[model samples]
Target: MFTIEHDFDATVITLVDDPARHRQEDVTVNAFEDCVTLEQYDAQSDRVMRVTLSPAQVSDLAAALDLPEGVYKIGRKS
Candidate 1:
């Protein structure tokens, strides 16, 4: 596990694996303030991806992420 900082944005992105080699570009994420949870799974195989995020917006965090009130944040598993 490791932590990395990016120069272009407000949100801090963390990766558990070698995500730097992945082809996906930095995505614009929408969530509750700087707090959120993201999950991904491969339907073809049994690969699982689960992520829980903490809010990074320093301003009106709720407004910045556009998250609804009913949403619940996901906690880290490891």
Candidate 2:
């Protein structure tokens, strides 16, 4: 399951793991104008872990998801 909210500064998306998947904790993604942040709770560390990605990195990641197993670079459209 997932939920999305629009904040003043950013859009927040929370991803909840399915019970059938047997996964604990949820992932939260915050998309800001300048960058994107992915966050999740860490039971072992007793804290939340966050990863930030630049706009370019986020675009690359989106493109990468549709690709097969191979190295590739995204080129600008003319």
Candidate 3:
């Protein structure tokens, strides 16, 4: 399950492992105007881990998901 909320500075999206209990901490994504952040709990480190991506990186990631095997470069539109 997932939930979405629009805040003043960013859009927050949380992914739940189980909808019924809602106890398990799942992944969270925060999208801001300039960048995006993905966060999840790390069992080994006993802390939350986060990854930040720039706008360009996010665009490349979106395209990479639908792409077939092989390396490719993402080009910007003029």
Candidate 4:
């Protein structure tokens, strides 16, 4: 599973992969669009080690977060 870790000193995000609970790819909380800061990425691996979000993008992202009452479905293909 994914864990959002915060550096108490810096307050930066550090997403971690917990060994016991791996997540399914269909509904990943860590999913994000390709960076506009640069056209191409150098990392060849599947994991997204970092991200940069625009203000409007972040606002839309906040609303896309999970809801109560089982309203937020998981593992569905978008």
The residue-by-residue lDDT of candidate 3 on 1-78, one tens digit each, is 899999999999999887565466699999999999999998888999999999999999999999999999877886
User: What's the distance in Å from true for residue 51, model 4?
Assistant: 3.2
Highest TM-score scorer: 2
lDDT of each residue in 1-78, candidate 4, tens digit only: 334434433223333334447532321233234321212223466554434565456555556774444444234233
Give per-residue CA lDDT, model 2, range 1-78, as digits (tens).
999999999999999998876697999999999999999999999999999999889999999899999988888675
Candidate 3 residue 76 C-alpha distance from true site, Å: 1.0
List, residue by residue over 1-78, the lDDT tens digit for candidate 1.
Answer: 434454443434444444666643233332444465444555566665556566443334555477666645544345
Descending-lDDT candidate ranking? 2, 3, 1, 4
Top lDDT prediction, candidate number: 2
Alpha-carbon lDDT, every model: 0.47, 0.95, 0.92, 0.39
- Angstrom error of the Cα, residue 54, model 3: value is 0.5
Clashing pairs in 4: 1-21
**lDDT of candidate 4 at residue 32, scale 0 to 100:** 35
**Which residues of candidate 2, in runs, are more than 4 Å off?**
none
C-alpha-based local distance difference test score of model 2: 0.95
Go through the candidates in order and give the clash count of each.
4, 0, 0, 1
Q: What lDDT score goes with residue 16 in model 2?
A: 96
| Candidate 2 Cα deviation (angstroms), residue 23 | 1.4
Clashing pairs in 1: 34-54, 34-55, 34-56, 35-55
Q: Which residue runs of candidate 3 sit more than 4 Å off their true CA positions?
A: 18-25
The TM-score between candidate 2 and the true structure equals 0.91
